[model samples]
Target: MEPVLLAAVVLFAGAYAFINGFHDVSNSVATSVRTRALTPTVAVVLASVFNLTGALLSTALALVLADRFIQLPAGTPGLGILIAGLLAACGWGLWTWWRRMPSSSTHALVGGIVGSGAASTLVGGPNIAESYQVLLQQIVLPLLLSPVIAFVLAYLLVFPTTWLMRYSSPRRGDAGNRIAQSVFTSAFSLGHGMQDGQRTMAVIVLALVAAGFSGTTGIPLWVQIFSGVALAAGSLFGGWRISRTLGSRLVRIDPLRGMSATAVSSSMLFLGAVWLQIPLSSTQTMTSAIVGAGANQRFSTVRFIPLREILVTWLVTAPVTALLGGILFLAISPLL
Candidate 1:
């Protein structure tokens, strides 16, 4: 039973990574695609490559997730919760993607785990207080503040970036901004991979520990490769509908603004993943950055309705997914 449950957990984790890839790829490439900095194919390829590279480079955030956020009991019960949580996260991801909403996959996963963890506590799992403290300090705070910071910084960044190109003609400015946007797109893709890939890695590690495959909650190379490859494949597939939401519908973004948004987002990603060792929603940060850059140009240029809708989605994602995950755990645990 443990072996079978472990296999299922690993498989579901990979699938979740794949869903996350296409689901969140828009964050890295949307602005560049919108501004014509890169063709869709080129942008996707760039994202895939860098995302894979980023996934390979970091385990710090993964460690934090596996060790700090929530601990699962060994054997069947733990594996069952993880499987249900992944399913709930995946379901929300697919729904949001279908609706072309730029929601936070990070929040969804966290919510799922939280719900599952809470459920587990009802059945003799570890105390939820410590995990909740970690969640608030590490996950919730960073996820919430990063977007607001991204918005403000991107808004301010437009001043410098815009000034630098003020002397250039439209054609020349677009060309320069395209080149810069591509550079930042690569950086953002790398950071996105590192941050999001770690989420998958942490899940796989938890599964491994619960299965007794490993006594420790460390991310192994095979786990990294597995998570990275699945995520990269998803990125290669791309999410055209959500891409359109972030790239075009959110704002009529110019190349310069696109570059600024990506820059701001990538910086925040690095800060969260590398320095803070926290999980952030690249979706929120990038989307907020895009809005900030757009908002700086003219209030009317930034569409409020979609922004409002996206915000509502963000606000509700955790709690809704938590409910879904908890319900899923209850429904599926018996069968397992």
Candidate 2:
């Protein structure tokens, strides 16, 4: 690949990362903002800043995931595949955003990559492993289990805490819990930065490596800083639509419930980033936590309609994006 082409690919990847950041920022701060724990502007600013700080805190996991997923065998993938994958991911993301549905950008990107890779390999012929263990163990497992774990954890954690505090004065408890909620919200923002922000960095790094601008697993400092800043800026802008859905429509979040959900999400996210080394979606985990917390309050608190929409979005994100990716790859293959 020529230097100019490589640079162009890197730039495209950066833009994709920025989109990811802006699109997903609401996942971290929506609850806090909706509950009046933070004003929208303040929530966005704080979340964005912490997110940037968190990105600087972790690089190893992102690098590993990037190497595993993005850098295909030399000559196995071409520019067409890359463009298709990105466009498909972006397109699916925008579709979900338009409907105010909470979908997984991570899944969309993964689907795009898989679809494009499969298509490119079928056409160009590469001996890449179709059934890599990392894909199953790291990507699939986390995606399948993280939400369940978050839901159960939040459900279990919230009720007991609330029960214990039942005898306390409501006003005092609310005030104290509000302060605690703020702390937990900040922690959630930090964890969100650590986990979710790294995903964009990983994607950009993968693009650079794919275009031969960077060696495998070696993400540039500028790339990291740029991705971090872009994501933070996006968070600062915030996504109020999703925030309303997650924070209010899902359940009425008292400070205790909010704190419980945030804690569970942060814990799951950090474990995935540091131990499991998987790039799980913060939005999914948090949503599950919210559901769990709501169920703990009352089974009826979990709204089935909105949840069904979310599930449908999740189910469709991968396949639809994959199909789009495959089609786009084919269409652009002639030019590339």
Best by lDDT: 1
Tens digits of per-residue lDDT, candidate 2, 1-336, equal 445445555565666666666777777777777667777777777888888988878887778877775546443154456667778887887677777788787888778867776777666745235535666777867887888889889989976788878888988777667777777777777777777667777766666665666675466788778778877777776556777778877777877788788888888878878887777888799899988877776545777888998988888888898888888777766555
For candidate 1, write residues 1-336 as lDDT tens digits. 888888888998999999999898888888888888999899999999999999999889999888887767777888988997898899999999999998998899889878877876666655355678878988899899988899999999999988888889999999998998999999999999999999999988988888888844467889999999999999999778898889878788998899899999998899989997888899999999999998888554988888899999999999999998888887876765
TM-score of each: 0.96, 0.92
Q: Which TM-score value belongs to model 1?
A: 0.96
Q: Highest TM-score: which candidate?
A: 1
Residue 146 of candidate 1: its Cα lDDT? 87
Cα-based lDDT for every prediction: 0.88, 0.74
Candidate 1 all-Cα RMSD: 1.5
Which pairs of residues clash in candidate 2, taking residues 3 or more apart in a chain or in different chains?
none
